[model samples]
Target: MDLRTANMEKNWQLLAGGDRQGLYACFDLFYDDLFRLGVSLYRDVDLVQDAINELFLELWKIRERLGEVRNIQQYVITIYKRVLYKSRHVRQEFASLDECIEMPQSSYEEALIAIQTDERRKALLQQALQQLSERQRQMVQMRYYEGRGFREIAETTGLTERTVYNTLHNALQALRKGMERVE
Candidate 1:
């Protein structure tokens, strides 16, 4: 393993073992990457920073229960995405009353329908994700969620570029088939 990966793994193990410095080390190592990911997903610097802070706090609270993680970045990122998305949803829910009142009834109705449709699509996508094998799911997330190129994925995953491509291709096909079945 490379020095960076080795360092992350060591810190991950230390965090699991109840070392506060390990947690600090991990936060320092991953903060920038996570911040970039958060901003890319939501485009709100404050919200992204808040989400990252919350994520580390939660991790520290649950450190002992985390057990072994094969890939620390991927694991933390998956949790971070959930936290960021949930935060965004909560913010939307508390939007100003005046804003709601200012919208016309027809426009409000259309917005509600659009939101419902989006919810349905999200549910369908979740179901599709569940159908994929663990490896395929990882590849899909790295490629789409983290926006990593195939070569980067291959290097990080220790898979050949061709294998990464094939895995992602098959994953997309499976997702397409699953969505088609639903439609």
Candidate 2:
């Protein structure tokens, strides 16, 4: 085996054998690159850091059972991707609840109140949306309110598809937080 692969195999064995220093060494080798990947994928440094920390903690917990990883770098990245996916799924679920709340049917008097309530909700949402940067607000409006696809938004806005997705993701995150505060 090559030198780096050999070194990684040795470190993996040591970690699986429960060597504390070997665990630290593995972390030192992998954390920075993993953090960079996480940040690029998630767009939130704090959330990425939390994901990395949780990933290492889980790795430590299950190290003994992890068994014979051929490539430690790939293995760690696979685990990290899973963690990031789960984190994103959770955030989307909670944010969807806040952003897409449903209303029930009511009588005329209640309907009038509902109309006023809807107006207030729209004002609150507008205030929340205003807090985002102009680019983010535009991306969000195009994607969510205007019913444009990412590719269409990209074409119209002169941004790449990935850039549109990232901008809308950050915008939605900010809108969720702002709406929470407004409510």
Candidate 3:
């Protein structure tokens, strides 16, 4: 392993051993470098920040595997790269770095208000889903909530692949129009 990876392994061990301060220190050290790489690809500052947040979230989620990561920088870079790759593959590439939206920090009460707003939106979506036909609901749930590909949904539902694809597309368009009306 490289020297950086060796140091990372040590940090991972420390973190797994409950040394949170050490983990945070390592995170701070790597954050700027990783963010630069993410920004280089994504161009959007929010995407850069989101990529870092997701990378860190994945790191913590797979903490048990951290010790196996010989190259800490490599691991973090891979996370950001994979995120960018996925975003591009999913057709969600950011428009531009200059177009990044900045969210202002809110006080405790405002945070609670924001949380309630999010809850209402989620409830609205749930209500909309409930209004979908059984087939539409199943397709939506499979494609999104369960993260299945069209081919996979076809296999599961015994529908032809084209039928599954068309159903999902139409269902999503309907959902978009429905949400527009609600909004």
Candidate 4:
């Protein structure tokens, strides 16, 4: 493993062993990445910060029970996504009465079904994304999630524009096939 990955694994082990410093080290190492991911999912800085803090606190609390993680970044990200989504959902639930009334009213069952369907689709998409190569996934996120242009992505990734386009195209094709297999 490279220096960074080795360091992360060491800190993860320390944290699991009940070392406080390990918690801090892990926080320091992952803060920027978690922040960026939170911001990318939701534009609210305060909400993102709060979610990240809560994530670490929960991790520390459950440290002993946590099992070995092969990919710490991905594991944290999966948990972080759930936390961030729950935070956002709670915030929306408390929206002003006027704002709430402005929307169309649906029965509880209908809303529940819609939510389940959306969650299923999201899960499927995530699985499909995980099937892609790292470079393909990165390019896909830049082009779609970050709304970056082909030229800009090419410049930032040190890849030619044509290469970026081709990569994205292949990624999309792969994603389609993956999703289709499920349906």
Taking the candidates one at a time, how many backbone clashes does each contain? 0, 0, 1, 0
Model 3 lDDT tens row, 83-152: 7667655544545557756656444455446657889888878877877889989999999999999899
**What is the C-alpha lDDT profile of model 4 across 47-108, one tens digit per residue?**
78899999999899989865577778898898899999999999888997677645444544
Q: Which residue pairs in candidate 1 collide?
A: none
- How accurate locally, in lDDT, is each candidate? 0.86, 0.80, 0.73, 0.87
Residue by residue across 1-183, what tens digits does model 1's lDDT show? 899998998888899988999999999999988976876666666677889998989899999877667778899999999999988888779997667554333333454466578899899999999999999999999999999999999999999999999999999999999998997
For candidate 1, what's the RMSD? 15.8
Task: Report the lDDT tens digits of candidate 2 across residue range 11-116.
Answer: 7778888888778877877877886687667565556777888888888899987667766788899999999888878766777655865544344445446557
What TM-score does each of the candidates earn? 0.52, 0.49, 0.43, 0.52
Query: C-alpha displacement of 169 in model 1, angstroms?
Result: 67
Q: How do the candidates rank by lDDT, highest first? A: 4, 1, 2, 3
Clashing pairs in 4: none
At residue 42, what lDDT does model 1 achieve? 66
Off by over 4 Å in 4: 97-183
Q: Residue 42 error for model 3, in Å?
A: 28
lDDT of 2: 0.80
Model 2 RMSD in Å is 19.4
lDDT of 3 at 77: 80
Model 2, runs deviating above 4 Å:
1-3, 95-183
Candidate 4: residue 159 lDDT (0-100): 92
